[model samples]
Target: MNKTYDVVIIGGGLLGCTSAYYLCKNTDLNVALIERGMLGMQTSSLAASLVTRGRATRPLIDLCVETFEAVSELEDLLGDKLDFNHVGSMHVAQSVESATAIAKQTEMLRQMGDHPVELTIDQAREKAPWLSIDQADYIVFNPKDGFIDPYRLCAAYMQGAKASGNLDVYQSTEVLELVKDGAKVTTIKTDQGDFVADQIVVAAGPWINTLLQPLGSGAAMAPVRSHYWITATDPLYPVTSPVVILPEAKAYARPEVGGLLFGLRDQVSKWAHPTDLPNSLQGFSFDEDYEGWTALEEAVEPFLEVCPSIGKVDIHHYISGPSGYTPDGKHVIGKAPHLSNVFLASGCCGAGVAISGGVGQSIHDLVTGQTPRIDLTDFAPDRFGDFDPYDEAFLTQCAASRSQKKAG
Candidate 1:
């Protein structure tokens, strides 16, 4: 007889571990977190880990704010240090149009009860003396924004959930299929064996499509690869440099341990899914083709002009990984429409690490038949309209438009 669990969570990235942590903490359910490979070794560990609270939409903004608050106190909750640096963050606008957008964002934030301060270019430069403010017209500063160690945060959740003695975490175990009887999932078939469960939560990140494809849900989840660059630590670089974003360029950077991590939003064509376990330390060969490298350098030029020392810095490394994205660019976080007992928490785009805690909490509420802490109608699995050819074309165009604006 296969061992049965009250709940079996698929994908042990930040989303999965977080869900496990919350379920164990708040419920009496027997939980098992299954990972295809090492825990948090996939997209979660490879994430840029910058935590922020601003977005193009209201639902995401609200979720991000809530998650930022939870992550700020994560160490206290876990009784362990997560190395969360409250260095604050700023979004710089290089043009009048972008500056106007920043102003609108500031107003929206204010309406949301957030304290987003609008700063002139001079004020921004004063706050961060290393920044070049010549071309920048305006900036939006949020003091509560910062970065965290994704690995440490994942470990903290796993450790705490394990200590609860109600959770079983199985790393390197691949879930092969979701066994369902009628509308309820009854068992999770894995490469090693099978485990029965009353409820299944899929927070598989980029690998979500692969797992869901077998169940004919792949079209709803697609993976996009994004890359980031790192620089050797410099004495002149402030450790408190805010998580800076050049919205016009779609580039962002933040201070990290002994160095600075940065990345642009240029995405190449999608590649086939990896068959092996995910590795975070794998380095990309930018030497083969300099398109992405050139783009990153160009985007960083404005900031580098403000700090000449930054241009002289050597490239420490290149980090690349897949981020799950929906056709609509919103997360799919409620129940799978065709399957009642299976819940989805995937397709977080690039914001999973920032909002994993809140996503987990919301999933837990759904499992217990309670209203989610945040409104999830916008992220529902069934919100994509009909999957017809016309709808697909429209979605593709919208996604392209959004990507162009984001990568500009």
Candidate 2:
């Protein structure tokens, strides 16, 4: 007989793990997490794991603050340390125009009750002597932003969910198809076998399209390649420093265990599946392309000017991964319009890690036919008007155009 579960969640990343944890701990549902490969080995592990509470909008700022608070105490709840470093974050603006924008953003943060300390070029240099403050006109520092070990956090959630005895996690299990009875998902067909479920949550990240295309829910999503680099550390460059973002340069860097990790947004963004995720783990012959590194180098040039010593830092290889994005910058979270028992949690862009906790709680509430903790009307999958395969090309073009203007 096929195994029966009250809820079957696809994708074992942070979203899936948190959903399982919340459902198993708070509800009476029997849950199972299905992953195509090892848990947290995909985009979840590749995430920069940045937690920031500063945003231009009120709702997004609230969400970030809520998530940061939740993740800060995760270790206390799980009885294991999450290895999060609350080094805060600094946003540096290169030009006068960018400085004005930063000033506006700082005001927005203040309105959101987060008073980010403004830093002059000299003050920023004093704080991080390795940065090139001469290239930047202004900097806004937020003390609440920080980074976390994404793999450890995912593992913690998985372990906690498993300990509840109400959850079963199937790693290396790929969902082949969704068996639907009219407008409801009745079973999930996987490589191992089939499992009947009362509810299904699709949080498959980049692979979400493949799983949902057949459902014909008029939902659209796009995947973009993102790359980051790590620099060898020295005693002078301590990990206590905050994560830094150079908005004018279209790059960001954060302090890691042994060094500083950085990445940039490039012009040539591709949209295709390489049959495997890009990285060392999959034994894929991947190397950092010229355009990506060039962007990173240009973005951090000002920082290096203020902190000239960092220019001599050893390079720690580059990383490239895909981020599933929606037309708008917000995530798509809600029940499928055509299927009553089917739910989706994709289109996160790069914000998935920060919002997974709240997303999990929202998914749990949605599955139980209760009101979500937040007003998710703006993130509904049905918001996309008439989606089609060719729509991806248009969406990708639009995203590329927007990025180009942003970088220009």
Candidate 3:
């Protein structure tokens, strides 16, 4: 069978789903979202779902703000609240270097007109009883930071797009090839059938290169392994505790129903060789034999000082996922330099949930020939100079970006 639509978006994860929502809400373009599996079932679902506003960069911070605003907007549009809670965030600095970083981060927030409150150790301890403030030198708290269930957020975007009456989502549809005519992608060969569209957006996350390789185009991102551990429920983690960012520890924690969810940046981050990754994440995962215990042992030492409660609870579960990471730890958005009709929106560096709304709006703007509300030069897909996504050295570079992430 053959199908046609005004636009066909590949990868129905965070970027694709949210892009569909913005398009349907703002335009009349008939859109079809293609996914190899269920929506938001991959990397998007693996996020800790902390939508913090204090990012390392201003552009990224602005993008974070857009997501915060998006939650409110979506609520008004659907008359249904998302899983977002304004429980706030605490940034603890355990060393001079980490303290300086927090100082710069707080200054950036103030420069952006956001009032991030500087807290005394006592105040931070009162707010986050589980975190050891005695180990902290500087503490900054932002009341607007919060976390949402990524699955629910993605579902809300899908529902919002469906409500537009102009969007159709094809689940379990795998895009096999992107057949180009002249300079444009004319035919998308999927397992189900062929989809012809005027424009194609490859928001395919880590698997983006698989679909774009034949076109001589690729986003400068590789699949980097990201994982987290959850502790058993304990009174130490109050249900409404603020999200915590510990740069010195290279870890972060957030409240989860009297329990706590935390993640750490191991010195050596794992990058799946592209060939090892599959379109569907159902039965496939990184082939680490130790199941991250080796890495966890190396990474969890610093985080324990701040949150000693981790020692008291049995780890309820562990989850790991691959997020598209770039060599520069920035986003890869905007149109492909060679492929005029394709827009790349990957390389989020595990911040996909925090910046999805801005990514969606930018994609919609470029697709509809409207000006992007914010400058997008930093997110241009081809910014890192041309490089093969499969190159070993380049892949390691991408992994390093995620491994050294200090900001939560």
Count of clashing residue pairs in every prediction: 1, 6, 0
lDDT against true structure, model 2: 0.71
Off by over 4 Å in 3: none
lDDT of 1 by residue, 245-345 (tens): 87766667777665667776653323223233243324533234433566565456644655565677877777766666566667788887667788888
Q: Give the TM-score of candidate 1.
A: 0.87
Query: What lDDT tens digits, residue by residue, belong to model 2 across residues 1-408?
Result: 798998999999887887787677678788989998888888888887787766545555555565665565566677776766877788887788777866776788887687699888777756555576556677788887788788887887787677665888898898998878888888899999999998898888777766676776634556666667777877655778787777665666777776878766665555544234432234332344543466555445644554566578777767766776666666678887687888888766677777777777788789888987677877788886667633656457525632442210
Better-scoring candidate (TM-score), 1 or 3? 3
- Give per-model TM-scores: 0.87, 0.87, 0.96
- How much lDDT does candidate 3 score? 0.86
lDDT-superior candidate, 1 or 3: 3
Clash-forming residue pairs, model 3? none
Q: Rank the candidates by lDDT, best first.
A: 3, 1, 2
